[model samples]
Target: MSERMIRVKDIELCTESFGNPAHPAVLLIMGATASMLWWEEDFCRLLAEKGFFVIRYDNRDTGRSASYEPGRPGYTFEDMADDAIAVLDAYGVKKAHFAGMSMGGMLVQIIALRHPDRVQSISLVSTMYFGPGWEELPPMEAKVEAFFNSMGEMDWYDPQTLLRNAVDKWRILAGSKHPFDEERVTALAERDIGRALNYSSSFNHSYVTGGESYLGRYGEIQTPALVIHGTEDPIIPYVHGEALRDSIPVAELLTLEGIGHELPPAEWPAIIGGIAKYAAL
Candidate 1:
């Protein structure tokens, strides 16, 4: 059944809880500035069907949850990890499987590192470990700054805009032959940003602040982790996934040769299968 109106540290996060509550829980964390809605209905249902009590919530600054300012120099990725942990505490959950995408993946890494006792396993998708040389990680300084700064929101009077946007991003991060499904891209844009502002200063600030960068600590994780990356992913190079796999003990890697940075809904079967395999362990 769907759950509603859960409180996580004063922020009213929208959560969807399904399947047996008695089963071990799986926390579904969305990417940076992305609403929990972007997790996609079919994928969430698939996880629920696997005897997992799934919980997907909006981050503090995204969706229906509270948005706090950096409120000092700024908030880092560690703060995001704390937010995820706080959600589990609010639910009174002792431990859970952690799944995240993009920045969400980084937060899950932090959560596993900081609160290892609370994690059963981890599944990270389209992510990177920002080891040393983060400031110099290719694409030139000017392009990198502009890339993070230009994630503006858009309206869908013409759906092609969304397709164009996805293609453009993939082109920059992946080579031209890298394929991305148009429908999934549109759905992601619709579910996550169809109603909210296109961009947030806080998200931009958080990115530049290096809150999501991980440097040389992947070997420290003791949990089972499944890292999935598209071979053609543009935004996060596939090398990031390989590095994570090499760092995390017992971590398995899934590389989709034809896919781009955006993993499509059509691939839910394979994605859910990978998650289920890890969750079973």
Candidate 2:
């Protein structure tokens, strides 16, 4: 894989590409506050090996991408969707299969809704169809409380604190059947901390609210879609994935039996294979 900065609209996106551009492209978008690295390098290569040119990039505020204030981002969610299009434009790809996790999944839905002509297929993993307050099904009360309480205690000034927080958060959200890997999570947190801006703009994703209505527009999506969710997901309930499957006429839902809100390392093969098959068809 090769990494570089690509200009998208008025901002520059840090992007990593795998495989030949000549192959069909699969764009991966990560969740809120999470960098493109959340998609995992090995996972991208596996997809590429499955005959896809994979692209993963940091969204506006995360990673090595452009930085913004920690609060209100100047752009809207539609603009976030457009950022994906901009990445495609830079790569000279007119239409490509898209996959997103968490907030990234929401962005892909917008991309399909607003720019149908530019999407070949879509895959949403561990994400909800609805925007922030509009989720069809909300997460468990205890989990929600845990998330907020943890965030409240986080010392954003110390990157080490942020890394520790991430490790703890993953443990809470990871699938029960999958053994949590402290070492791997630590490595990812360390890498992200080194590259992340001093003041993170992750909260900006929640502050921007215009896309709340996009959930109502799922009926307009005609592209083939695959909705994958963990049956035990506590952050975004499995019901959210069911809602997406029902709302999109052509969408398919896959439930991972013992999984939670996270995409565990063990599930990569199945997830990547599912996306490749759906996109290839």
Candidate 3:
């Protein structure tokens, strides 16, 4: 694997890749407030072994990527979508299979709609549709809502406090099916916080706005799509996956039973297997 900084417009994004560049490319976009490390190195390697060139990157305001003032992102969600294209361009890849989680999934949808030619296939995980019907879908569970609301009270600057909050967030999102791996979660949180340029800037994702309306446009996507959602997802209900599957012409849903809004180590094999099959790599 190799890591490099690639320029996109005026900002630089940090990217890491696995496997042969000659193989089919799969760009993995992580969720909001998360760096490429959330994609997990071992997960990327396992996917690479399936004959795919896997690319994962830090989105703006996370990890080693560019950052802005905490409350002012200065870029729209659409610009972030364009950043994906820039990453592909930096790698000399004209087209790639895209896999994204949570907010990353939303970006994939935008890319598929806005730049169809650059996408091969899409994998949307633990996210809801962004268009018109989104309001009708179930809201996040009460506990999850409360947790996000409570973020204002936490101290983001202190490493120990940040670590504790991160661990707590993961625990809440892990659902009831599997045992919560506190040790593993804590270690990852530590690394993510340790490697960031300005970890606090990640919160800017909440304020990002898009210039265009994607209203009722899900049906316009003709590319093959795989919508993966945890049955127990608190942030985005399972029905959102069903909505994507039904709206997209060539989309299929992969239900992660007993899982939550997370990509736990236990589910990596299944998730990887699903992607390999879906991408036909």
lDDT of each: 0.71, 0.85, 0.91
On lDDT, the candidate that comes out on top is 3
Q: Candidate 1 on 156-266: residue-level lDDT in tens?
A: 345556546544553454334435455555556555544443324225425435443444577778899999987766567777788788778889998777665554666
lDDT of 3 by residue, 39-90 (tens): 9999999999999999999999999999999999989989999999999999
Clashes of 1: 4
Instruction: Output the lDDT of residue 160, model 2.
Output: 76
Q: What C-alpha lDDT does candidate 3 achieve relative to the native structure? A: 0.91
Error of 1 at 145 (Å): 7.5
Error of 3 at 265 (Å): 1.6
| TM-score, every prediction | 0.80, 0.94, 0.97
lDDT-based ranking: 3, 2, 1
Please give me the total number of clashing residue pairs in predicted model 3: 0
Compared to the true structure, candidate 3 yields what TM-score? 0.97
